[model samples]
Target: MTTDTQTQPSSDPRYPVGRFHKPQTIDAVAIETGLKTLEELPRKLRNAVADLNDAQLATPYREGGWTVRQTVHHVADSHMNAYIRMKLALTEDAPVIRTYEEALWAELSDGKNAPLEWSLQLLEALHSRWVMMLRSLDDKQWQRTFVHPEHGPVSLQTGLLMYDWHSRHHLAHITSLRQAKGW
Candidate 1:
């Protein structure tokens, strides 16, 4: 008879916030909205895990998913790569950005065991700088493209949207886990 997030599992735990939608048309308003998501992630994610002790941090958001600790670290990892990719796209023409094994990265010593403070602090600083640069991009600059070896060419507008969705996506994982476990 009880219907709460804890009692009712989301349709797909992997995508509590739903998947990212590639926009048919991305304008400045859309870019600004995405920037807000980017701007807010550090504070939002930090608060999501603020009170969780190490034991809770080690709990996975879902079956076969990254633990909360790894999730936080992974955000730092992924966002760092994104920041660099954006920089490269702006400086170089259709730069071929390198890819990484995100799953494997999540299993590394830093990702798996390092204090969340380190990554949280890094995100605060990284997002600050990233937002500053993103805000300065002109309409012509937003059209800049970067090529992921696998995903093909990605415009800055699209990157902004994806990372914005990504910001919400991963944050949902942690929050949804907390709700489910009644933590």
Candidate 2:
């Protein structure tokens, strides 16, 4: 029986690299690896969106997801918050970190229509400073903790892992789209 039925892509397009899962323990090796990933993110991300035109950038990686443009800007916005959170954790005793509505942030005009270069450049500079800060942290500093209203009591090590995974996760979203579309 040859009944025609359209088959959609098997995988979840929104999470091409799967979701982030915090590790049970954060060791020196894990910290080293996470730092390496953080260092490489700016370059990896830049390469992902390179040569993409406005129309291509406007195209969503998934059917009902933010456009590539929004994704890039969101990375900048999110990473900025993370950098500040790191600083706060270093200074305070488990400070409560603020959370914003990322979906709403993506709807802002700058997120939707601003040039990707702005975010890319911001990411590069921010990451450079962030990497420097990460490298300068002592063992005690890495043990610093922050409280998220939702997650609660996030250590610096976990924060590092989360952002490292976050970098790869979002990069995969764009790269997978490029491969799927032959871009």
lDDT of 1: 0.90
Q: Which stretches of candidate 2 lie over 4 Å from their true place?
A: 1-10
- Write candidate 2's Cα lDDT for 1-183 as tens digits: 011111223377776666666666677777887788889998999999999999999999898898999999999999999999999999889999999999999999999999999999999999999989999998888989999999889988889888977887788888888998999
Candidate RMSDs in Å, in order, are 5.6, 7.8
Considering every candidate listed, which one attains the maximal lDDT? 1
Tens digit per residue, CA lDDT, model 1, 102-151: 99999989999999999999999999999999999999999999998998
Every model's TM-score: 0.94, 0.92
TM-score of 2: 0.92
| Cα lDDT computed for each candidate against the true fold | 0.90, 0.86
